[model samples]
Target: MNIYKQIKSEILNASHIVITSHKSPDGDSVGSSLGLQRFIEKLGKSAVICHPDIAPEFLFWLDTSQILLMTDQPQEVTAAFQKTDLIFCLDYNGTDRIGPDMQALLESATCKKIMIDHHLNPQDFPNLAVSDTSASSTAQLIVELIEQSGHENLLDEHIGTPLYLGILTDTGSFRFPSVLPRTHELLAKLLAAGVKHHLVHEVLNDNNTASRLRLQGYAMSQKLVIMEDYHVSIISLSKEELEQYDYQKGDTDGLANQALSIKGMKAAIVFTERDGMMKISFRSKGEENPVNVLAAEHFDGGGHANAAGGMSKLSVADTLDKIIDLVPKYFPAQ
Candidate 1:
């Protein structure tokens, strides 16, 4: 059977379902999982949403209070995994991205597995997978799945809110190039369903605390370093600097994009030190510049053409040097 049919069949057959996403869940991941969970509950099945940990506070506005935040292998999630008849992995494409614990459960579970995602290069694990890289967000794909599964009439505020958050955050509030006509149509549907648009906006964009604002200022002033060629920009923040500025986990949400705004910059990189290793985020301007390829090839990460991320064992300085060396290969004229 085709992917859509397979997904519909799985939803129909599932009596007990577990929904999960990758570690350090983003808006798309959390939003997709919650949206799918609510949809499944509407079918009168028992569904549980589980993630590695609590999502960022800003995302709390999406009604994630009931989500199971598992730091380790808890009895609840383990029992759910054992008993679940169906498992839905949303947003993430790879098991490694989901971290080892959940990956193990997914690999060992007797339940049928379905992957609903929009990310490029998905892992081959699911019994049924619905992957559309063209879709703006996994939540959007879930919306399509609901429609295909004859659950459109069941969509309510609980489901629509998270779906709206997923599309909004993934498309950068519909400003990114990924936003298409269908995306807008979905947004219109979500709005008509009474999803609180202004509240989502306020929670996502307006919840920046005073400390986060100060941290952004410090990062912009002290950490942002532009190359003389103007082809690349790098921003590095140490754990010390973050503490000094009272930075929170979600404080640096858009800092990488800020580098891209600089005139003449072709590529931008953000390097942050967390738990001794360097976390790097990459962004590029045009189709010819494949930041994701660079991330996969050079830094052990992969994502879309315009955005990517990876982690390195190297210190921040070494990672920056390594990334700088790679700049000439992509932008040779510089």
Candidate 2:
């Protein structure tokens, strides 16, 4: 039998299952977890979503009442991990993405593990790894799993909504080059299954809070710095500035993308001082302007060519200086 069939068999045999995703949950992480959970439920079995942290407030509209968050309910998450017979890891390549606490539990767990991810360089951790770096999103992989495992008939609005959300956000609403023809085909299937695509769009894009808007506006007006020589833009915000605006987790989510929208900009970097470190986000336009290498080599982070993340222990001012100094080396002036 093929791997998909084997995965289905594993799900069927397990009595208890848990679904997990990376820390600092985003659309793809939340969407894939919920999508997979709903899919598993359609199989006459059930699973629990155990994430390292809560998703940003904007995603609260989804039915996430059942998720076990390590930050809020560590004991419950721990109990779930200890009792689960099967684990589904989604949207992340390695265990480290789930943070140190969950990493410890995941590393120590003896249960069977399966991974479905779209990122590069998947770790050798899962019993079955279904990683396709070229795929648009892990949510797309979940859709594929449903069709390939012969469970396509079980798909419904509950499952398709989250899956559609995962693909839409991860692809930047189909603007990213990672999208393929088959992606649209799968989307059509989801639409046929009664996924309210317009509602998903409204819920994600139209639900911004006043504080979020103000925070984004402040970042754009005050913190944005453009490196004309290297065609890169950088935005840095201190913790105090964030607090002044009542900053929330997802407030700065779109700053990097907005900076990259400049006419001559090849890349954008946004870093916020929080949690005793500088949390960085990278966004780029073309293959020639890949930012993952810069992130990996300089900031201990890596992701897709156009988008990545990293961190720095340096002070905010020093981090900005470091980035400006390093921009020329990676993204030469155009």
Q: What is the C-alpha lDDT of each candidate?
A: 0.83, 0.93
**Top candidate, metric TM-score:** 2
lDDT of 1 at 49: 89
Q: Model 2 Cα displacement at 143 (Å)? A: 0.2
Superposition-based RMSD of candidate 1 using all C-alpha atoms, in angstroms: 1.7
Cα lDDT tens digits for candidate 2, 1-334: 7788889999999999999999999999999999988888889999999999989888888877778999999999999999999999998999999999999999999999999999999999999999999899999999999999998888899999999999999999999999999999999999999999999998888888898999999999988899988899999999999999999888888899999998899999999998999999999999899999999999999999999999999999999999999999999876
User: lDDT value for candidate 2?
Assistant: 0.93
The numbered model that scores best in lDDT is 2
Candidate 1: lDDT of 57? 73
TM-score per candidate, in order? 0.95, 0.99
Tens-digit lDDT string for candidate 1 (1-334)? 5566567777778788889898878899989988888887787766898787768777877777888766754678878888889988888898777777777877899778888888899989888888888899999998888876666788878889989989888887787677899888878878888888998887787778899899888888888888857478889888888888776677888888888888988788897888678888888888877789888988889888888898888877788788778887876655
